[model samples]
Target: MKRLVLLLTFLCPMGFIALNAQSSSIFIGATGGANLSKFKFTEDLKELYPASNSLLGLNGGVTIGFEVQNFTLHTGLQYIQKGSEYQTDNFEDEQGTGFYSATEKLHYLSIPLLIGYRKYL
Candidate 1:
């Protein structure tokens, strides 16, 4: 995590500098989306739950883009929420219900850098 942060700290400034030096047409944007996530247990853990269900998650981020002629450079930073829930029939408390549920959540920071060329036919 620390390494990821450090790398981004260094790369972001350099990316901005490179974009400014090369392109006069710069564009900034923001993006957001939703995801459905599920967990597939391994063979050893399959006995715990018959199946896992999908959970709704969200992601959003900012984008920086530089364009010159037919070529473009793009980069962005995003935050993602991901996880899933599972119901198990084997686990039981003193009540003897033999049913339980669990949730797992994960948060992530994502950075994407891309370069592309566009052509008109």
Candidate 2:
């Protein structure tokens, strides 16, 4: 589950907007270092236990938007999860064992701004 979320998060942003055959274009994007991280029991427990500020790893997913003249809508699905640390009293205890991971995934309609310079090759 966690890995799935990570995969989605990483992929969804590849081509959120796309043009038509007339346009024919590809998108370019990138991010900082430190792509994904290992699972942390403290963080996982906190995200499930309490509701507070938390830190987490990043996942990716890609969406392909079609071009309809001057503008277009990019619609697709996404699955993402984050590393967290709550350290509160609201979750099962794990002593040197291992905590199950958490993930978020869903199919969605994503609309992005597509100029007249994008299309399929």
Candidate 3:
């Protein structure tokens, strides 16, 4: 069935890579870090949201790399948290509605692929 072929197409490569972890040309590693995020506003808008603070977040991921001669390929899967906590200045809208403060939190999954060439100095 087409489903079976599709499944195998993806799974086969993973199997080969797992089995070949001992190969010198292939490497696997973990990555992790912290992130500080905040928002910036232009001069005009700055007056409307005069106060803000950086939000602290986390990021982590696994990376896989393959090397061939002088060329290399890298890819990874990662989790990231982003957004900020912000407050608005005491400003009234046309209808006189006042706004105060709020925090925004966001979560994301990241997939990145990169290719590189190494030159010996």
| Candidate whose lDDT is highest | 1
In terms of lDDT, model 3 sits at 0.83
- Candidate 1 whole-model C-alpha lDDT, 0 to 1: 0.88
Ten contiguous residues with the weakest lDDT in model 2? 30-39
Candidate 3 C-alpha lDDT tens digits along 1-121 = 9999999799868756754664438789999999998877789878888888899999999999987666677899999998888887587767666777789888999999888899988
Q: Score every model by TM-score.
A: 0.73, 0.31, 0.64
RMSD of each: 5.0, 13.2, 7.2
Q: What are the runs in model 1 whose C-alpha is more than 4 Å off?
A: 1-23, 94-96
Instruction: Write the residue-wise lDDT of candidate 1 on 1-121 in tens digits.
Output: 9999999899979867776677469799999999999988898898988879999999999999888767788899999999999998898779999998889989999899899898979
Task: State the number of backbone clashes in model 2.
Answer: 21
**Which digits, one per residue and each the tens of the lDDT, describe model 2 over residues 1-121?**
9999999797656535332235643344432222333334576554564543345545445566554444454544444544433334444556733343344322233334433454556
Q: Which 10-residue span in candidate 1 carries the lowest summed lDDT? A: 15-24
- The alpha-carbon root-mean-square deviation between model 3 and the true structure, to one decimal in Å, is 7.2
TM-score of candidate 1 to 2 decimals: 0.73
Question: Local error of candidate 3 at 61, Å?
Answer: 0.9
Model 3: how far is 102 from its true place, Å? 1.5
